[model samples]
Target: MSAAILFDGPKDAPFTLVLAHGAGAPMDSPFMAAVAQGLGARGRRVARFEFPYMVERRASGRKKPPDRQPVLLECWRAIVAELGGGSGLVIGGKSMGGRMASLVADECGVRGLVCLGYPFHPPGKPEKLRTAHLETLRTPALIVQGERDSFGGRADVEGYALSPAIRFTWMTDGDHGFRPRKASGLTEADNLAAAIEAVDAFLAACGG
Candidate 1:
């Protein structure tokens, strides 16, 4: 059986959001918990799951690198299938997890995609982008990004040829996880609240 962590909201919630953890965090990290709670409060079911490597790390108490792309994709497939095959479901997550969701979203035919912070390219390596598949994405998507994130900031992503189906919402001066610097005069809580609202709107528009 596949191993995963799930957070259930109101039993009769119309839709469920299946969220994955980022590269370095567990399924119940603060960020994941916050988003899940925010969505749940708004009357949506939310679930969180870890990739295989993270699960191993949890059991063994040793840090491990994320699984390969193929493995990650396979894990996503398994989770999606286990979660009822995408009916009334919006699938996504933080950074790396969101990127992986984008890769398989169309194939899985989910109701919608919500990427908390998309890593368009590696930090300090803008030349190495990971957006080849996004250009032709068929799934309805919402990407909430920090304006100054090292991964794919506003300035950098403006130049990428993203799919029209994907909409980007920017958090003022926030970083990869939507935490802005003090100099920006914006609090982390403010940006996170904004991101949550944007995601809610996106999901509503998509009929989720």
Candidate 2:
């Protein structure tokens, strides 16, 4: 993990956000770009980095799968170290990236955490939950999920005994990436704006 590729906001901004990409996308994927830019516009410095596998994929132009969980965890740790040991930083990302960050947040002692479109389980495999650690997680965090996400919808997540420190904001009629159905009368931009606002408020509440 070299120094992260940054999409800087204001130089003297009060907050720093460190983000990693999901399993299937690069750090600069459209989804990542939107969140980074949206948040950056609101006055926070944003840093985006890739895991080992994604970096390789970028160089080779090959569609490689995600790294093993341990490697991803180590990658998050490295990013945390690079970003000044996390004291005044918020750590999170999209889906798998966000999940990996959650695995290290308590250990890193980050100021906050945010997850966009968290995948609670593999598609159509509801029983294979990836939420055990989230149950007892102590790091203040927000999971902004789409209402109809194939991975984890509102109904599915409502049954879990998640940590008290965790909060959720459901994007109406949204799929995994938060694109709502046309009939729902809400555009993707609407959801994106709502999600950004939710994250902004979450960061503010963290007082970082």
Candidate 3:
């Protein structure tokens, strides 16, 4: 019942990190690739998978909207069950992928959750916040988000009622994709390294 997976790093690693792709991209997107490689090189097993719609899109070579929320959550449920009920595991991904993981992390009984570029709401619509569950989320979560992400910037998140168990690593001046403007004196690569480092530290803290 598991989605096909693209895996990286040692199979025998202490923990496995499962990542899903964003709404508009595949599992091998440059951003996902970089983070998976970076984290894998640091000695964690990483796996990436596509939702059914994305899989079909690949086969048909056509653009399609994301699956409905129920379908998306079911995909995560299957993925979690495939990965040994999420024990000693971390689940997350870029944007929508990450958001879906957050929705299932506590339910899966995972050791931890990691969300890269979590969307607080649809872009240009700040009134529709997607953070109600986050306020009470457990599962020792870490969110690595762009400081100025169009979806949910640092300023916007500061006023939200997120859980105390969740910590954040903000990529300074980075956009939704974690790319910084040249004037910020920080490259996209730099922010990626920071994000990877934060995840590594978090995993170590979790005894992985």
Query: Where does candidate 1 stray beyond 4 Å?
Result: none
TM-scores of the candidates are: 0.97, 0.97, 0.97
Question: What is candidate 2's CA lDDT for residue 199?
Answer: 89
Q: Write the per-residue lDDT of candidate 3 for residues 1-208, one digit (tens) a residue.
A: 5457888889998889999999999998899999999989999899999999999998899999999999999999998888787896899999999999999999998888889999998989999999999989988999999999999999999888889989999998999988999999999999999999998898887778
- CA displacement after TM-score superposition, residue 179 of candidate 1 (Å): 0.8
User: What's the lDDT for residue 55 in model 3?
Assistant: 92
> How far does residue 162 in candidate 1 sit from its true spot (Å)?
0.9
**lDDT scores of the candidates, listed in order:** 0.90, 0.89, 0.91
Name the top lDDT candidate: 3
lDDT of 1 by residue, 102-142 (tens): 99999999999999999999999999999999999989999
The true-versus-predicted C-alpha distance at residue 82 of model 2, in Å, is 0.8
Instruction: Return the TM-score for candidate 3, rounded to 2 decimals.
Output: 0.97
The C-alpha local distance difference test score for the whole of candidate 1 amounts to: 0.90
